[model samples]
Target: MTVRLRPHHLLCLLTYIGKGYSPAFIAGLTEIARRVNAGEEVVIVTGPDDICAPLLEDPDAHCHNPGVQIRDANAARDVGALLDRDIRHGLRMVLTPVLVAQMRAAFANQDTRSACARCDWAALCSDIAADGFVGAILQAQDSTAE
Candidate 1:
């Protein structure tokens, strides 16, 4: 059956994945979203726990069973850590190019901005220097250039 997709539904989906739900659970959620979007009453069936609490809080979010999954704390933590590590490692591979480019651009912009703000050629250098030496080499370069 299908249920209409909503903000809370997406939130729960993300929250569940973040909380280290199994691949099966993640696939189930994808089907649920598809069914829901197709206009079926998709009910998420998961054990009760803090992990799924956010979905429970939403009145519209329905579940078959509402109670915590009775796993030992140590087991749960280990599983959570393993899942987190795997997921992050996967993401690092997938996102490395984009993330690296973004970081490079950000660092470059920061360097330029810092030089512009603290360089001797910068209008505010007098004020900045009075406070303390800031990015002095770049400032010196700017002064020599002028």
Candidate 2:
């Protein structure tokens, strides 16, 4: 099965470390991370996606926020440029080790962080990148090209 994701989530998965708004949210994201690391196909979507699923029922959910949409737009732009592919809805891919490694390199350099502006988790993600992604839950299952 495929994992449905929003563009910004492409960044979030890079720094996931078993934390989130709630236990259920963490659990849901953890499962998604597992699937993604296992080489599942990923399909980009427009709005609230698998990462937002556990919080969708909340009255204050940020899934549909304008800022969130902006983040998505920024992510699409950044990741699309990095991959040289349009990172839009229905764009399909597998996050191979080489690709993930390249993304991580860009992330570590803050090259793809326009999508993280105003995000509550931005600092944590930045720290994860700076720390060489230690303790991150979603590790590539193979050696990176480096």
Candidate 3:
């Protein structure tokens, strides 16, 4: 099954290191990270993707926040440009090793980080990238000839 992800989550998957707002959130992200690492395809969605599932119970979930919508838009723009694809709802992709390397380089250089503006975890992600992604959980492999 494809993992449903919001646009910004494409970036989030780059630097996730098992920390979150709560234990449930961390568990959900960890599970998704594992599945993604294990080779699940990722399908883009407009809002409230699998990463937001654990936080959905809150009436004031940040997933529903308007700022998050802007973040998604920015992430789509940056990632789309980097990938040379129209990153819209229903787009399917895999985080292949080469692709991941390119993305990580861009992320480390802040080339695709417009979406990280105002994010609570932005600093942590920056630090992770600065440190060569130490402790990051996701692992990517080339699934096809490129």
Candidate 4:
């Protein structure tokens, strides 16, 4: 389904991004909410997050809450396969804690350092050079790319 953005969603989105939320998470939640309101069967597959329970309480929803298993999944095998599927079919649903964290941190800090250097998207986001509103700006770029 096509997502129609109103002036307010966009405005609130901008504000949220400025606060360090990840654009992907924002898009994912918006998409899910749209589907839920449209009366579609929305199945949310996500890692654990503080807000997941409340969000899933809405009707017409199902949730798969898996904790972060990024490392356990073995990036090359599991992640690559998931990416391959996503590339061809797009995401089946939206609701992942890792995505949430990414969005939250994206809005909170624009610092270049990744707390540690192992952040996967660091280079793509110039996270190593992030500061001030840099993270939010990068997320905007990410949203367009998506």
Candidate 5:
């Protein structure tokens, strides 16, 4: 079974180090990070109801079974859709110079408020983005290094 990951998932994989969310969520994210670090292609589904639903409903997965609200799910789906669109347009890999720039621009743009407003790590993430994403990526990599 494949998991359709979003830009938020990419952000989490890059910055999360055993903080926020459940342990299961952290572990799942870590696994995804491992795949990303290994240069794996993270597939992303296109529709709102396709991938986010199962992720929200599964206990051993992203949501820990409590089931995410519609708003949250929609937000995640929208972020994923944006990431997928960027990827299709030659953003071949996540964390590349172009992709990072795109992510930073998306976060900084006022129009994308819904993407970050609901995030628990928004303040810190915004600070990280503002300060420079390379450091944040390295910090996350170092923190997760085995």
Candidate 6:
């Protein structure tokens, strides 16, 4: 099955190495990640707030806590649009090496501090990027490229 790929999803896949999010959300995201690693054709979904708001509203969801402020809706939309454009016109796939490289470049080009201000994993993500932990993210490769 094709999964809807979003910028937040890509960021989570890159930086989330351990416990976070509700179990149900984690399970669902894990399945999506698996499909992505298997070279599945992902449909870019730029509306993260729409897709995630309900999930985050669940009391069991990790993001439901008061301390975790939701990301700015406009910024999320902008980032998602950028990623969608890059995936469709630039990379053609959501989880390919080329896509990853392009994403890293995009991150480099922007002041991610503001973009990631609401993310709980932002500090950890910055460390991962500083440490050049691309391998940690790329290890999701589970299928031969189609």
Inter-residue clash pairs, candidate 6:
none
Maximum-TM-score candidate: 2
> What ranking of all candidate models by TM-score puts the best one first?
2, 3, 6, 5, 1, 4
Task: State each model's CA lDDT, in order.
Answer: 0.30, 0.91, 0.91, 0.32, 0.47, 0.52
Stretches of candidate 6 exceeding 4 Å from the true structure: 46-92, 108-113, 139-146
Clashes of 2: 0
Ranking by lDDT: 2, 3, 6, 5, 4, 1
RMSD of 3: 2.9
| Tens digit of per-residue lDDT, candidate 6, span 37-57 | 677766655444222544755
Model 1: per-residue lDDT, tens digit, 79-116? 22433432211121221223323322333333212213
Candidate 2 residue-wise lDDT, 14-62, digit = tens:
8999999999999999999889889999999999999999999999999
Tell me how far the alpha carbon of residue 10 in candidate 6 is from the true structure, in angstroms, after superposition: 3.0
Model 6's alpha-carbon lDDT is 0.52
lDDT of 6 at 24: 63
Tens digit of per-residue lDDT, candidate 3, span 64-105: 899999999999999999999999999999887678878888
lDDT of 2: 0.91
Comparing 1 with 3 on lDDT, the higher-scoring candidate is: 3
Backbone clashes in model 2, listed as residue pairs: none
lDDT score for residue 112 of model 2? 94
Give the lowest summed-lDDT range of ten residues in model 3.
137-146
Tens digit of per-residue lDDT, candidate 5, span 34-93: 555555555543333222443565565544322233334444555556575543211235
